[model samples]
Target: MPELPEVEVVRRGLDAHVTGRTITAVEVLNLRAVRRHEPGPADFAGRLAGRSVVAASRRGKYLWLELDGAEAIIAHLGMSGQMLVQPEGVADEKHLRVRVRFADGGPELRFVDQRTFGGLALADMVEAAGAAVPAPVAHIARDPMDPAFDPDAAVTALRRKRTGVKRALLDQTLVSGVGNIYADESLWRTKLHWARPTEKLTRAQAGELLSAATEVMTEALAAGGTSFDALYVNVNGQSGYFERSLAVYGQEGKPCRRCGAEIRRDPFMNRSSYSCPRCQPMPRNPHV
Candidate 1:
């Protein structure tokens, strides 16, 4: 799945080419593409047609285009989704799901998803934290990279969780944009076991974990985020190089970068977690 850095790169691309453009036409190549638009494809196309995109914004892993009205087109790139901006006459991608053409005859905005897990939706905006965001996800917590993120408040809240540290980090209500890969990387950086009890962490330790997450993600954002496969790429179809710099996420049975001990992979919530066994020892009585 695309995380904050990967999604932010796409948002930046859209802001560069798609913002300020008036939608002259909308082609829903597949009904599943607009599955999130509860009013259906016809309404989706009708509602988008003359509205100009004012801005391309993102909240954590969520991306959206704010239109002239108090509505926006929200997108979530579920596993294998790509937002591409191509020349008008370019060939349609093999999995092209939606296409948006502009009135100015500029390059077209294309949404392509191989798994179909991603979709588009028209959402009304609601005021939250002095900014307008899609009403459905207004309750989500601000991410570490977000300017509005409060480090003190985030650490305080994280220490209050009764769950395991990694589980708490994965909770969107607690902290946003962190997915499995980054979660393991952040833990590796902080030298904190994934199963450590959140409530047991000191305020300083909690803050360090948040700082680690921000540091690693900022680095990933600079590197254009991790891309182990072609499924995740920037709007211009460029792959990220962060995968080559990963510390532990997928380095199973490999030597730890810090202590030279073997890195380990353990089952975690239907997924897998990678860590340096010597650096991040398991807790005596790990919280569930």
Candidate 2:
């Protein structure tokens, strides 16, 4: 799944390419592409026909296109979803699910998803965290990169949880944006084991963890986000290079960049967690 950095990169690209453009036509090639709209594809295409895209916005992993009315087009870029901008006469991508043409008749925006797990929906705008966001994303907390993000409040919420520190970090309600990859990187940077209890962490330690998460994500964003495969790409279909700089995630049996200890992977929530045993010593009473 695309994380905050990847979503933010797509948002930036949409803002640059599609903002201020009016939708002249919308072709829903697959019903599953707009399954979240509930009213079906016809209603979905009808509602978006003439609306002008005011801006492209995002919260955490969610991306949306702000329309003229108090409504937005929410894009769910699930595991293998993509939003690609292509020239008008170019051949359509094999997995193209939705093609949006603009009044200007220039390049068109395409939604291509090989896995079909992603979709588009029209949502009403609602206030969330002192800003207007699609109603579906109202419950998601502001990310570390958000201008109004409160690090202190996030730290307080993180420590209030009884879960493991990494689990707490992955909680979108506490601190939006940090996913499995970034969480492991952040924990590695803070020298905190994934199973360390959140309540056992001092306020300083919690703050440092959040700070490291912010720092690492900022760097990842600069690198266009951590793409391990071709599935994750920018609007221009460019893959990120941050995966080359990863320290622990998927680095099983590799030497830790900081301490020379071999990195290890452990089962975690049906996935996996990576860490350096020497630097991030297991807690006396690990939560997992």
Q: Quote each prediction's TM-score.
A: 0.97, 0.96
What's the C-alpha lDDT at position 110 in model 1? 95
Off by over 4 Å in 2: none
Estimate every model's Cα lDDT from 0 to 1. Answer: 0.90, 0.93
Which stretches of candidate 1 lie above 4 Å from their native place? none
Stretch of 10 with least lDDT, candidate 2: 1-10
- lDDT (C-alpha) at residue 80 in model 1: 82
Candidate 1 achieves a global lDDT of 0.90
Q: Pick the candidate with the highest lDDT.
A: 2
Per-residue lDDT of model 1, residues 1-288, tens digit only: 588899999999999999999999999999999988889999999999999999999988889999988999999898888999999999999999999999999899999999998888899999997878987559888898888899998898898889999999988888898889899999999999999999789999999999999998999999998896689989999989999899898899889889999999999898898989889999997875
lDDT of 1 at 107: 91
